[model samples]
Target: MTRIFSALVIGLIFGAGIALSGMANPAKVLNFFDVAGSWDPSLAFVMGGALVVTAIGYTFVLKRKAPVFDRLFHLPTRRDIDRPLLAGSAVFGIGWGITGFCPGGAIPALGLGYSDAWVFVGSMVAGIALARLARHTMAARAAGKAV
Candidate 1:
């Protein structure tokens, strides 16, 4: 189908971009995290480039009446910074500092057959599962008026 082919092409492009940008290298990410000795700031340039590209893409998407493939562009309406958001952000930052790999970069890093990448990805998935379980438990407790 057209959608499947389009998705594959998009994924390949994204993967190639990550590889080309040196983002798939754990050492580069680890270097960025290291502030004391031999710290590399090259990742900052990659982040800047990504930010610019994302901003432009978002602007273009907003200008369109509807997305090319989708019936409508679904954007998040929530603007409030709540407790869960703050806590999750803190956890993510700590994990990134400790593991040196975010989910996006982790996939390609895994493709390069790095053992650390597998460990990071496994831990990340476990964390996600644990978070979801906690959320469900909390929701159930709140429903019972137990808080």
Candidate 2:
């Protein structure tokens, strides 16, 4: 219950930050990507500020024995740069560049009632579903081969 409450509070804070920072605007995001044209550096500042805050927070938080909400930190252990990672990254970049909306931005942008945001979010869900299906299919094939 405590963990759930904490997560809810944290998520709300994050959403509020996104909304306040003007990151929910697709035009701002698109402008950031327009390097050859009028490239907006505002997103870079926001990202830098976020990175700095995260760095400072992580530095302090990691000094503790364990996370407040979890028994373990649950950090990712994989360090290898593999094909799926590369492919997924490329797809994500392409989608973001074209639509000016990543999943994080798009989800909040829906509050503004933009058609592009709606379409982006819908497509994002479909992509996630397809990825899950592909994973399941691959696992089944692997299991069959092992038998």
Candidate 3:
């Protein structure tokens, strides 16, 4: 299908960009966080460039009636900063600071055969699974049912 193919192509391009930008390397990303030691500012420039591109792209893309693959644009509807959002943000920041692998970069880093990538990706999957399970259990409890 066109949708599936488009997604595949887009993902490949994104992965290539992450790799080419050195964002897939844990050491590089970690160094970016390091201020007193071997600090790197290239990643910051890369992020700034990405932000600019995204801003420009959004300006043009949002004007379109709908996405090429979908009848409606699937954007986040929530704007409130709730407890779960804060908790999740903290978790994500801690993980990134410690491992230097955001979800987007980690996936592409897998192709580089890095051990850190494997560990990060594994932990990310486990975390997601645990979150889903916890949500389901909590929902069941709220309904006065055994999970």
lDDT of 3 by residue, 1-147 (tens): 988998999899999999999999989999999999999999999999999999999999999999887899999999999999999999999999899999999999999888889988999999999999999999999999987
The sequence of per-residue lDDT tens digits that candidate 1 reaches over residues 6-119 is: 989988888778888888887888899888987999899998998999999898889999988889989999999999999999998888877778888888888877789898
Writing each residue's lDDT as its tens digit, candidate 2 over 1-147 gives 998999889877887788788888888998999999989999999899999999999999999899987797988999999999999999999998888898878877888677899988888999999999888889989889541
> Between the candidate structures 1 and 3, which one is better when assessed by lDDT?
3
Candidate 3 structure, TM-score to reference: 0.95
The alpha-carbon root-mean-square deviation between model 1 and the true structure, to one decimal in Å, is 1.9
Per-model TM-score on C-alpha atoms? 0.92, 0.91, 0.95
Better of 1 and 3 by TM-score: 3
Where does model 1 exceed 4 Å of error?
A: 145-147
**How are the candidates ranked when ordered by lDDT, highest leading?**
3, 2, 1
